[model samples]
Target chain A: MIRSLAELKAQAKELGPRRCVVAAAADPVTLQALSSAQKEGIAKGVLCGPADKISQAASKAGVSLDGFEIKDCPDEEAAIVAVEEVRASGDFLLKGHLPTSSFLGAVLDKEKGLRTGRVLSHIAILEPASLGRLLLVSDGGMNIAPDLVTKLDIINNAIEVAHSLGIEKPKVALLAAVEAVNPKMAETLAWAQITQMAARKQIAGALVDGPLALDLAVSEEAVKIKGVKSDVAGKADVLIVHDIAVGNIFAKGLIYLGGAKACGIVAGAARPVVMLSRADDAETKLNSIALGAVASVV
Target chain B: MIRSLAELKAQAKELGPRRCVVAAAADPVTLQALSSAQKEGIAKGVLCGPADKISQAASKAGVSLDGFEIKDCPDEEAAIVAVEEVRASGDFLLKGHLPTSSFLGAVLDKEKGLRTGRVLSHIAILEPASLGRLLLVSDGGMNIAPDLVTKLDIINNAIEVAHSLGIEKPKVALLAAVEAVNPKMAETLAWAQITQMAARKQIAGALVDGPLALDLAVSEEAVKIKGVKSDVAGKADVLIVHDIAVGNIFAKGLIYLGGAKACGIVAGAARPVVMLSRADDAETKLNSIALGAVASVV
Candidate 1:
């Protein structure tokens, strides 16, 4: 229902300030984004990084975080502490100066991390004029070449995140090169299996269809033109990518070249994780925060 | 330099009518698009399908083809005949009614098919306003789960097509989940090798860099923000996808949900093959033909 990013922000503001637990937030851009988000009343900052670097970054970015909480810790320790903190009291977790390995390691920690017996995957929300909806693309960051079962978890994770964004009964398209299953094209084969599983009440909460090409899944006209019949065609709310490399490039292609606005989050955790890139605009970072906040509430 | 789809078509017209040989030319949209191209002096069509069916399709689309050539052939033999005809006289090929399997069968035929010793691939033109450039995504339609060597061919093929589009030295972004190369990530490994190859002039005609995420590849601001330094970070002309399934879905996600206008063509062939789907608009189909026209000449 949000017509524009501005409206999405307004909706974000109404949800109240989000509690973000930042891990090793020592980078200037990371701090700057967090500072901006805080100023916009989108999120309340919980900085967990090397205290000296964090404060220096804040000062360099001309941000006075007198009201912000700075939890001093080394990068590795910050990752662990941040996740633990978020799991205990915060609404969401964010990565900062820590290495991605350590940052993720902390979150995937069996005892203290936020695991929900589900696959942790990255989903990007992109708004392109071509589709006229907030499209979600998944597993671009976390999962590599996922097997059939991992794909099911990825889809379920994306659907839960979509529901959090208030899209009830999301149309899920398992993308492949063709509409029919081919043994050589593993993606189509996987799509066929997933569709069957969804039909058999295996993957729940989303309408699943696949072995669909990119054009067919999002363009109803393409569907009609191809004489392809599917409930999810041209109306897909979620596009489950075949692999991380493809998803990563495909999602980025849209945002960078396709005039799309995007925000990202790692889903299927006990609590949602904000993984908005430093490259994302303030609006995108804020939207991601809003997305994470919404998902957290859900 | 062309801004919109209209400009792309005008540019196509400036270059003169293209010579196209369409296999299984019984689809109405294909006929209509070709008819428009003919009317606008964008392309010269050689219809290769069942003669009656081609005529019927032309009539169905309300197009009068008084000066066109129609090659009568059954769907089973249409692909081979179309490939052979195009190789002999036509400039490019188009998919019409035949299945992709059959169409590709003729294209990959050992002796008669249009094989140039390079793997055939699909490169989609994505025009997203934020970047203000025609972004090319490849291997989304033809190659499935390409290995390192095949990835090289895909990049080479995409680079060739990019050069034909007047992007003399296109920036090729080898995308992955993150910018850094990780041993666990196969895409990053491939990207690292590809970047080195491009640097050493093994892969010519493009500025290639990667192990980059979506944002870093296209958003220069993101490059600075993330401090991820690379020449291709924010100005990638071509994004070489890992496989067809990912490329297909990723491109579609942009067109359908990100508000982008896309034109798809099979590149890295003897001649670029424009396969406009029945779902694409007149402009998309025409633009693809224009792209093919330019690519064919190169």
Candidate 2:
């Protein structure tokens, strides 16, 4: 029932400070975001890149690195070091300037990684101006073309995040273009299977239903107009997309065109991960940290 | 380019009148629409249904049956008779009170109906007040699970409709959830293939590109923000959907939630087909007829 990003931010504050370890923390924007998170008392972080470069970035961004600890490693080794640090402390793994693939590779390393027998899926939570609720879209950044099992993992990952955000029973919409199970559309078939699975208590911690269009999933007026009867209709917490493309485009579209703000994280690990795109504005960056910090508590 | 639905109506007016055959035209909304279209000189229709019932319905809706030619047949026989009438004239086929399944059965009838070599697809044209252009979405009503070949036909149909609206070289954005062609997401792969096909002149008569998200397809600012460079990135005339659901949901969302007016027609037929749902308002009904009128000129 946290309807707005402002409410989410306040809740993150209520959760107090969680620690974050940033890979390739020499990036000025990342340092600025971490600094802002620290200032807001949502998260504190260990910068795991070259100390000199980190210092320079902090200075460049007009941030004080005084109280913050720098692990002092070669920049290329930062992701590896950061992953181990986060794994040891159970703190959040925040990505900085490192390529996501390199950062994630270390995190997914079988021996010294943060795998929790679940898929590492990306979740972007949007607070659309009109929707008046946090809408979670998953795997837009990870798991390019997931099979049915991978999709189940993606849903579970998002549900965990939604639960952390205090949505006790998240309404997960397995979004397709429509609500019917058509043989031609693979996503609808998947949704039909998933819906039954949820009904049978297979996919727990969420009430999932779909093959819902964007409107039917979010707008009450549309639900009435279309006369679709469902508890999730006009009220969905998470939109489990058909694939990476659908989730990616939808997340980007809401942010860019629909006048919405978003926070993104990689879930299904031992701890939550923050990997805000550099293209994301400062507010989005800060929001990601708050979301990561709050979720890391669980 | 014809940007508004008003412009679409004017164009239909300029094309004069196209003969439309209405199956099961005994419904009040049906005859009302046909009567208004005749009054506006947009269409002259053959109403194939029980003459008495059609007249009564017309009177109830305050419409005159003076101009439109009526075929005195039982309501059950109307769909058959109307299909034959539209087929012979090679004009528009308007659905009245008939079940869509029955109407489509006649249209898809191999021996007698109006089956073009191409697949029959439904296109919804929206003149969003904010976007300021007619945006086309296909297969929302017809085509449950169209394969790549059927999708191609759908695109071609939409392009033809775009042409009728004065867009010479329509920018067709094969809309998926994301821009990246992830191996797992079938729609993205289809888009990538279609984009290459367009580049190779395999699919001509339009500049097609994809795996575009909604924002990148329609917003110039989003294109620059995301650093995606494509001719179809900012301005798209048509959005070729993954299947019926994407088109259905997106269109309904924009209209119900985003405050947009829409006109829908089924294309890729020998003649255009208009099937306004009972949920559709009066203006939408008239707009559909206008769009069909203009498209039928070809």
Could you tell me the fnat of model 1?
A: 0.89
DockQ for each model: 0.60, 0.37
The TM-score of predicted model 1 comes to 0.86
lDDT string, candidate 1, A106-139, tens digits: 8888988888898888898877754457888888
* Docking quality category of candidate 2 according to DockQ thresholds: acceptable
- Model 2 lDDT per residue over B138-193, tens place: 86777766888998899989999999888989999988766788777788888898
Report the C-alpha displacement of residue A209, candidate 2, in angstroms.
Answer: 2.5
Docking class of 1: medium
In candidate 1, stretches whose alpha carbon ends up further than 4 angstroms from where it belongs are: A1-12, A25-42, A46-58, A66-84, A130-132, A227-229, B1-8, B22-27, B48-54, B70-88, B99-111, B226-231
Where in model 2 is the C-alpha error above 4 Å? A59-67, A213-215, A221-228, B13-18, B32-45, B59-68, B88-91, B176-189, B213-215, B225-229, B249-260
Worst 10 residues of 1 chain A by lDDT: A1-10
What DockQ does model 1 achieve? 0.60
User: Can you write out model 1's per-residue Cα lDDT over B18-92, one digit (the tens) per residue?
Assistant: 788888988888888888888888889888878888888888999887878888888788999899999898898
Q: How well does each candidate superpose onto the true structure, as a TM-score? A: 0.86, 0.89
